[model samples]
Target: MSILIALKQQTDFTSTEQRIGHYILAHLNQLPTVLIKDLAAKTYTSHSAIIRLAQKLGFHGFRDFQRALTTEIVTQEQQAATVDANFPFSASDSVTTISQKMASLTINAIQTAQQQLDTTQLAPAADLLARANRIFIFSQGDSQLRARSFQNKLVKINRFALIAEEYADEAWNAANLTSKDCALIISYAGTTKIHQQFVAYFYEHKVPVIVLTGNPQSPLIDQATYHLLTVQDEYNFAKIGTFASQAAFEYVLDSLFAVMYAQDFHNHLQDLQQKQQLIQNGPLTTK
Candidate 1:
């Protein structure tokens, strides 16, 4: 469980400790660098009471608590920016205001994804994709659009991808895949029945499955060979749009493409330049 979630659910604390917790929650952006003395002074509590609050939340002390809190704060900085993922802008805002809010939301979402993903998971995920005989992406709706974008990027490196769910032929595509292939599943909620069936098939067949999802407790998490989690601030089905989720998906997919390209950096670059040259100055009418 995330420390942030635990902190929010705590119900048993002394008055002084409660005050300290409330202050930290209210000023999350500044809590990382805040001194214990200053925090206690602001909360009107003693330093010992603040330490007790941290310990109650399962940290060793104030410093330990602050460290974990900082990791979760990467996404919570939205609070400081006043950008709500569900409703970033009011209806009364001007045209430019909505545009600016979206720009900031995109940056925040990518930053959250970066904090959530680590090299330990990305390196192996890219390696699996690079070595797979074929890559199939499983997604639908907005996530399907992101999958198509990733499919296009992979082609530049000579890695072809198929949309497994395209044209309602998902069952046919699944039946055709073998253990040598890799399945890349993209979903925000990760609870669809069809996706679960896909995961089960891949798991039983010894095929590699790479799951990208925001839900940590998703049913699709257990059997995946590589679980790449990227949580955004978007709600389950009630938001202006999938602004944060799609941006995070693009960043994760781009990161995988970059790492795979670097595996054969010189050769990929040479191939790309050669292709550009032929397309630009070929004997056939280029345009």
Candidate 2:
């Protein structure tokens, strides 16, 4: 766990310890190079107070605490440098540099999405999916590509999902959905006019709409029966492509798929293994 989370969970600290904790959490960037005396003086506390606070948090002393803080800062800075949601690569970057950066950015995106995912939402979303008579996914562009991949996975698991490849197809599918069906709409922005129209249509049909989006405050949330938040720090108009958003979406979808499959864990695994064996054996020779 990060120091920030640790500090937030701590409630038994003395006033002096609280001050030290607050300072450390707020000044994580400066914690690495800061001396113990410097931090004590800055927080208006003493060395003993600093060491006590560190021990309270399970560290041996201020030195050990600072080491952990420095390590976390380094990891975060490295991820942030490469995972620029808007601008991942620079003009001066070489081909090798770009490849390394993209790999780092993709890894960071998936990790962040996992860390920030709301576990409480998982069961309910999985329940909706597992119980639905049919599933309809609405998305466009890269997000739609992820939706398609998710649909394919659901098919393999024997839970089929419907997705439209064009505007007309999307409208037709939306119009035909019933209350028994579940709708999962993927929108990074969550405020697109077209998506809003679809949401309104789904509402009219009383379809349970589950949204996967990064924007928590988006209008889509008001209409959605359930919403799964994804990572969005990498999305920007100035960015070259949709790298982080798609990764986050896929991670969430994969998690949801896993949860749904877990409902019948043995059966799902058996089905997959059977399919694999079929492929390995190939078709029988004609007589």
Total backbone collisions for each predicted model: 0, 1
Q: Which 10-residue window in model 2 sums to the lowest lDDT? A: 1-10
Model 1 segments beyond 4 Å from truth?
Answer: 1-65, 78-81
Q: Candidate 1: minimum summed lDDT over ten consecutive residues — where?
A: 1-10
* lDDT for 253 (candidate 1): 90
In model 1, the clashing pairs are none
**Clashes in candidate 2: how many?**
1
TM-score per candidate, in order? 0.78, 0.71
lDDT tens digits, residue span 152-180, model 1: 99999999999999999999999888999
What's the true lDDT of residue 151 in model 2? 91
Question: In model 2, what are the clashing residue pairs, if there are any?
Answer: 85-234
- Candidate 2 lDDT, 1-287, residue by residue in tens: 34555575454788788788888878877888899889889999999988888887668988898887787668767788665767888899999999988888788888767755766677798999989999988888789899988998998788888885455587788877889999998988888887899888888779899999877667897888887876456644768888888988899999999999888999989988888776767563233
lDDT of each: 0.85, 0.81
Best candidate, lDDT: 1
